[model samples]
Target: MAEITLFAAPGSCSRVATIVLEEIGVPFTYELVRFMKGFHKSPAYKAVNPKGKVPALIVDGEALTENVAILSYLAATYPDGRVLPAASTPMAAARIIADLCFCSATLHPLVTRYCMSVKIGGEEGAAAVKAVGAEAMKENAALIDQRLCEGDWWYGDAWSAMDAYLYWVFGRFNGAGYDLSPYPRWQTHAARMEARPAVQRALAHDEAAQATLSAERMQMGPGGAPKAA
Candidate 1:
């Protein structure tokens, strides 16, 4: 396989896929798209991802957008890595997809929308957006916590792409002050995910980004809310 290159930004959804790559032991490169500099919105970056978002995977010269697609593709191509189940049946695959959707459609988006309300709309709309977003995320987090309570991983016994995404979203919320004390299982999940070698690697790479994020959160006053990218 051609070396996979991930065009990513620190603290972006792309980081989830990047961590997947690390866990799978795939050789890859990561290019940081500086959010503060608006590099992701640049014409150069847009050429790679029309949405101009981070976490675009370049396999050879073809770019794959969206963390869900990239993660699934990596798991499919590297079955030996076993980061996700091969799914002996279609129904099994459907279950994994369902879990992934909970993260992508519900958890991830809610966090992103709330944090970036000022950029998506304006400060005038932020409070209303955050109120709705928080309720939605809390509900979504509760659902995932329920799943974690049932099993060690999001997809039963094995680690899956959904686990990586869920863990990342969980960290984002807790780090931003959503109060993980209410969700004990999810808090435990975050702690375990952080201890993984792959996750630790991702965090090391994301150190500078985390600093910027901390500063941004302080500026936002709660939520680590951001200007929408």
Candidate 2:
């Protein structure tokens, strides 16, 4: 077994970890959890990550949850990769960590809440919640645009996991039915990011999973519950 193993679901924020692992040129095995069946909530997975979040990494037998920790671990372990700041520059590393937290903690969850709130709150209440979520999405998008306008990447000219996380969160806007044209810089960032081999590979994997799930649902007929790929 590979020393580094990642438990992830395709198209989730776990994609960021996949990108970071690829960027750092680290080899690892992927353990895919069937989310639709509540695989993440099973006892077996809780041993790996008690929080039950995707992108949990088992490195040298110690499981690390949260994207920031996993990403920073990869970058720092492979410091020569140049995808992250040097440990010697504590301030720089701190800034990148900050950006990672903001995106993971704030931007990503807002979009997720907007998407799933209907299940928690009733449909009528969900509409109002989603409205607020949509506006927040725009504000976050604008914030990212302003950052990109100031510089090519979030931290600096060199791309880092921050850019990858930004790409993942902002990409959610398209599904949320937000107008992306206003954030030209974000669009440009997405274009540049899509050209990267790592991101391309991750996205292709996600799309394939979605297609497979769709086909399976079609086979099972109307009574069959469509599983989230």
Query: What value of lDDT does candidate 2 attain over all alpha carbons?
Result: 0.79
Query: For model 1, how does the per-residue alpha-carbon lDDT over 33-84 read when each residue is reduced to its tens digit?
Result: 7776788899999999989787899998999988777878888888987767
Give lDDT per model, in order.
0.78, 0.79
Could you report the Cα RMSD, in angstroms, for every candidate shown? 6.1, 3.1
Lowest-lDDT window of 10 residues in candidate 1? 220-229
Which segments of candidate 2 are over 4 A away from where they belong?
87-89, 211-229
In model 2, the Cα lDDT at residue 135 comes to 77
Candidate 1: Cα lDDT at 51: 95
Each candidate's TM vs. the true structure?
0.87, 0.87
In candidate 2, residue 5 scores what lDDT? 83
lDDT of 2 by residue, 111-183 (tens): 7767766865677788877777877777788888998976778865888888888888767767666788999
